[model samples]
Target: MTGTALDAATTELLAGSLRELLASVSAGGELGPALDALGWAEVLADDPATATTLLFTEHGRALVSSRALDDVLLAELDPALPPAAGSRALLYPHPAEGADPAPLDGPLWGVLLGPLHGVDEVVVPATAEGRTVLVTVAATDLAAAGGPATGFDLGSTWHTVAGPRPPGSGPPAPEAWTRAVAAGRRALAAEMIGVCESALTLATAHTTDRVQYGRPIASFQAVRHRLAEAYVAVTAARAVLDAAWTAAGGADGGGWAAAAAKLQAGRAQAQVMRHAVQVCGAMGLSQESELHRHVTRAAALDALLGGHMALAESAGAALLAGADVHPVVEL
Candidate 1:
């Protein structure tokens, strides 16, 4: 699906609220219900903030935390986590033990814990700078979401993070990577759209002003056709992006849909932006021209989210292998 740019106001609010959420979440007080108030998670006592800024080093083998998670526990559910490298203020989640009331040692834990389900099914907090932040975790679909002091609703299940990585293995969970890929896709799509729109605008304006045969190039049938083709391509890509968003909206079967959206966006965005530059002619290639920036942005997008060609090939194969595809919705 095409990604919409988050407005400045919304970005600001999320920034502020995210910091507050991190504070309350990291505090390890009554969870579940509190997390429900945030769009990040649902289920009473099912989520606890275990947000941390993690860096993936050397094929995801080493994860270094920027913050201190000493107050929380580390459950290490996946067991695929790599050894930690450097350390800052780091908190981690631990699998819930028995009824022993143990005080958190402070800024360090062996095992890790995380919110098992509800709300954060699609989203996880990671710093944009790829540095330090808070972390959280919770259990899904169980009355005793916690111990005697904690109880969680059982029927609901979703996804999000909880704690630090384990000492062995490499990288974090597949889910974390999945979320990162999705974010990268959204960012790429948004950038592509921006490029396509800018190219169209530039080409349209230039053709209107550039005269050939005593008339503007805009009057030429060939130029008109080029613009129309580019517009159509942009529209089609936009549709696919919209479909991706619908597929991601609290739906359980978003995996293939997400893949398809990214794949389509990757192709169409590349094509439309390239055509935009071509239609703009020599002026488009000029360093001073905004068209060049758009072209560069589009290229950057093509490389992000595991590269467009690879992703599209994989998605196409999945579709050919009888994987169900979701239809795009008009917005």
Candidate 2:
């Protein structure tokens, strides 16, 4: 799902441009047209790793959600499939579900979760009886079947649909779905990193500005300790994720690599959120603060593809089963 390497300077430029664009879009702008005007499709064709990292990281920073994930998942699933004519969304597997859960499960999450805001149609990939079924369903139809769920995450552009799979079905090429899952896992991991990092940044700013007892909370050792730990968690997450990116691009058994990335990112998300909220106290829990957005978004993203505990347990099982353990970061 992730490949192509750009020189450092080029990557930096790309990151800058992406940040500017995403920041604008996050403020108030249309996602598809803005990305098209910026030639996002071309950039994706050139370097997927750069595209996923820069764009999704900004998505985390600005709390912007876009259908850009469709590009990542669909490209790996079936590149030959042409883009849809109308606005569309791709529903993916939810966090609670297993690798291949029931097709009609209530929570119809997506490969790239969120950014499912305005699309009228959706591409749902359902697995059953060892066959992969790709169905394009009307979003309105899903709504008619009970619409989206207003769950814990009110800030994210998450649409939880529940419905039946349309008529036709057949399995795709071998390992196609597996590859798609790996790609989605890595992409979500990038976004989670952005969310946790932004949360930490927000916490730091708040602690520095909010004063109590004639001093800023940030100056206190207790607050400083929490923020410091959050930083370390974020840094550790990014390190493992970079290796996953490398494994996905060139090395074999990227499944484990991607899993590792998501696992660490999930753990980091919880750590960052816990300390960030604690440092900000009651204000962090308030909807007025930006921390809650990251909090809820991280919750949903962590569950998508795989959660920290789920992946760790699975990783342990794989090791015990004698599966090839690709600790891409191996010494």
Candidate 3:
């Protein structure tokens, strides 16, 4: 099935299950067992006819689920895991400090960098002689030798994984890496859409209940306009993500589509979350409010896989290079 045609029932079921699983984990529960019980890893491991749909649905749900349960689930349910043969693999440029490189380490180290919270293992790519190889690294091994201490923040846990890598699959075509990065960009865009939606929901609910000057703040024309603007931005972001998701399934030049999707989604997420916080006023900034989490997470997501500006530049370069820039959604 195409990414756009993903069964709503199945999507809802997966979302609900993930939400419940994460809730249980957040309430002083073990994460690994919970995921294992839910067969999450197995589902990711299962080869699908349409990788785009699976990745988009699962990544989107994970983000939405994380909004309710917090960012702890971000790394645990990484859509990039369960590295498969012929699939795209992300390549890192350097090793984390204090971590030893693998025997086959090339000039560029294969690693996963950024807000890696609860991520046990990550897939890395290495290219040589026109072929790319995939490798997996465990988080524990990364920091085992006293590398940069793992740390957490309002948005996510920032950690760097490095060291010896376990061989994943045999080398694939060079283009496979590009495809994998594009798919990842699409998944990240999907997650950003969820973050924006969650922030908008919070802003809408807060304005509706908060009374100011004997009237609900939501009743004020200014507040209403702000919310309306945020809603439109979120909707636009979703549309871009949907188009990118569909394109990622099989469309030619999917990488360009994914880049555009990420650029637009990142902009929407940043704008919506900021407006959401402002609509909530001082309380939104308080630690007690969930709005802050959404804001911080959105900021972090926007920066992931290079920020919106970088993606925009990439897309522009591609267009200049004669890549077709057609609308994925036809009116």
Clashes of each: 56, 5, 0
* TM-scores for every predicted model: 0.49, 0.85, 0.69
- State how far residue 178 of model 2 sits from its true place (Å): 0.8
Across 1-331, the per-residue lDDT of candidate 2 in tens digits comes to 4346677898788778777788776522356687788788777777777677777877777777655666667667654234565776666665567455345333354343443347666667776555666656666656543334357777555555554544544344336666777787788888999999889889999999999999999999999999999999989888888888778753333787788888999999999999999999888888889888889889877887778899999977877888655556545
Q: Give the range where candidate 3 is weakest over 10 consecutive residues by summed lDDT.
A: 65-74
What's the lDDT for all of these models? 0.43, 0.73, 0.57
Model 3 per-residue lDDT tens digits across residues 15-134? 677666644544222345666687755454442222333434443333432222222222322333354332121234332211122234443343343433454544555554545444
TM-score (C-alpha) between model 1 and the true structure: 0.49
Off by over 4 Å in 3: 2-6, 26-122, 126-141, 145-152, 162-173, 251-253
Model 1 clash tally, residue pairs? 56
Q: How many backbone clashes does candidate 2 have?
A: 5
Model 1: residues >4 Å from true position, as ranges? 1-172, 250-253, 327-331
The best-first sequence of candidates by TM-score reads: 2, 3, 1
Every model's Cα RMSD, please? 16.7, 3.5, 6.9
- Alpha-carbon shift of residue 319 in model 1 (angstroms): 1.2
